[model samples]
Target: MTVIVRDLRPDVPADTEGFARVRRLALPYILFTSDSVRHNAVHVPAEARYRPLVAEEDGEVIGTAQVHLAHDSAEPGQGLVNIYVRPDRTGRGAGGLLLRAAEEHLTAEGATRLFTWVLDEPAHRAFAERHGYRSSRSSHFLRLDLAGAALPALPETPAGVELRTAADFADDPRPLFELDTETMRDEPGDIDVEYTDYDAWIEQYWKHPLLDRDLTVAACVDGRPVAFSVAYTDGGGRYSTAMTGTARAHRGRGLAKLAKTHSLHRARAAGLTEAFTGNDAGNDPMIAINKWLGYEICATEVRHVRELG
Candidate 1:
């Protein structure tokens, strides 16, 4: 079977559905939907040069790639490509062809370095190494059975603090944005992100297709958000924690833990069966919090990098 790689047609429902299907099968830890796929393809900032590609064989999409520059990072020339082929469609040259196209596009767009995440399996790691990518930091995908696990009781709202949902801030989300920006500064990651673009943030985050505002909990201090747990639900009894963070000023107060717990209780009440979240291997604080919430490590992925000459 001959396979060809080309840019994903965002306007085509079949292409979007196929892309989401591959992602859901290959990386079940994360939430993916056809609407989310189309949103990213259409709403990502132009400076990022985001290009979603698909590998088609006999009119069937067998692989997918999300290619983009690190536009919001202070460091320039850093590009990212995440390629995943259907679990049943491996060994068909689909992944390699997708990577080649992604690399050529990023390199032509001035990328000096490329990064990708490979599942912590021998074959996956071998593929990256064969492509000149070296292993770097790793992360863990965690899972919690909301339907069966006994979650911790919702913490009492500390004096002078109130717990609220993201929906409560519909009239004004700037506070949440500011809080998110502050917390992101300390998030464990390889890239130093420059997150000052509020408009871009709104399009990429606040308006995301999977965002479940009712399930997203935030801790407010005198009506200003200080910590939050962003929630994304797939409308299929699967919920994921997109991000959970506390502003630096509020660190050590357990506000993040409180917010996350509240979010979980609400998620369970809403009938979500499973909960998923990911954390960098080195993020001890968040890891501890997730553990306390009964999350267990389900899988691990290693980041691999290749420097383009």
Candidate 2:
């Protein structure tokens, strides 16, 4: 069987379904849907030169890669390529072809460095190393039994504090956007990003297919949001925490934990059976909060980087 790498045809439903299928099989810890696949392909910034490529073997899409430059990063010439192949189709040269194609595209776009995330399994790590990629930091995927797990009771809001949902800001989401940008600025990562484009944020985040406005709990202090837990549901009894953070002024008050706990209760009440979340290995505070909520580590992925001259 000959495997050919080509751009994904978003207009074709089968193409989007196949891409999401490969990603779901390769990384079950994260949520993927056909709509999300198409959204990413269409809404990606022009400067990033984003391309979603799929590897086809005899008319079957067996692998996928999301390649793009880090447009929002303060430093230029940095690119990212995340590749995933169907679990049943590994070792068929599909992955190597996808990687090579992604590298060529990124390099042609003026990329001076390439970064990727590989699951921490031996084979995955070996594959990255073989391609001249070096291991860096790692992140963990956590899972919780939302339906049957014993979630902690929602705590009473402290003085001058209130709990709300993202839906409350529907009239004007600018406040939530500002809060999200502030929190994201301090998030630990290999790349530094600035979210200044409101329209892009609205298209990419606020209107995302999976974002459950009602389940996204926010902590308000004197009528302003101080912390929040953004929730995403797959409409299939699966719910995930996309982000949970507290503003710098609210860090010591346990508002982050409170918002997350409230969000989990809301999710379980809504009949979601499984909950998923991810965290950088070094984020101890969030890890502790997740552990307290009965989330267990399900998998780990290591960040890999390659410098291109």
Candidate 3:
């Protein structure tokens, strides 16, 4: 059994399915489909130099890796390599092979800092540590039983507040972009991003295959978006809240929760069974909101960083 790591062939049907299978098995918290996988491999921004890799043992894929530079980050030379192997195939050396390939590619691309997410488990942490990666921040994957969880009732629109969907702004989504720009800046993360390229945002996010425009709820105050819950559905049973945020001024009004609750209810009505969301471990406010929505911390992953010479 020899393991070989190579670039993902989106055009090949089996490679797409194999890559999606490994990701789903290794990280069930996120939603993935063959289409989404293929789209991501092909539609990545040129500046990002995104490369999706798969570790194939003989003819079967056992692990996957997404390697890319943080092009949008305010700081350059930050590379990301998220590797996941099938739970059943852990001891087969596939992980080391994938990591080696990813690191070589990223270092060649001028990466000075490399970051990866390792599941917050003993074995995973040990593997990262052995690879010279040091733990930095952590994050949690939260799950909610959309069918069984009783979501909070939708709140009444305040005197000036209104609820709308992302699709409602199809004619003009700059407002949502502006809202995202403001809200995303507040999200806790390793890299600081400045969303100045509206066109890039549109191509990278607005036009993604999984973005459910109708289910993405937004809160408005006098026609301006103040809070929003971005939804992504796999067109199957699972739905994930890609992001839920409130503007700096709208922090305490509970509008972010309101938007999320409304989005979850809408998702449930649309026949989605399970919902998933993720938050930085230190982001207590968002975690509390997810708990209010009956989301339990299903899994946790810690950010591991290494300096790339």
State the C-alpha lDDT per candidate: 0.95, 0.93, 0.92
Which TM-score value belongs to model 3?
0.97
Clashing pairs in 2: none
Q: What is the lDDT of residue 121 in candidate 2?
A: 98
Total clashing pairs in model 1: 0
lDDT of 1 at 238: 99
Candidate 1, residues 1-309: lDDT per residue as tens digits? 799999999999999999999999999999999999999999999999999999999999999999999998889999999999999999999999999999999999999999999999999999999999999999999999999999988777789989999999998899999998888888888887767899899999999999999999999998999999999999999999998999888889999999999999999998999999999999999999999999999999999999999
Give the lowest summed-lDDT range of ten residues in model 2: 152-161
* Candidate 1 off by > 4 Å: none
- 156: Cα error in model 2, Å: 2.2
Across 1-309, the per-residue lDDT of candidate 2 in tens digits comes to 899999999989999999999999999998899988998888887888999999999999999999999998889999999999999999899999999999999999899999999999999999999999999999999999988889988877788888989999998888788889889988888999878889998988998888999999999988889899999988889999999998898898999999999999989888899999999999999999999999999999999999997
Cα deviation at 85, candidate 2, in Å, is 0.4
What TM-scores do the predictions have? 0.99, 0.98, 0.97
Of the candidates numbered 1 and 2, which has the greater TM-score value? 1
Model number with the top lDDT = 1
Report the candidate with higher TM-score, 2 versus 3. Answer: 2
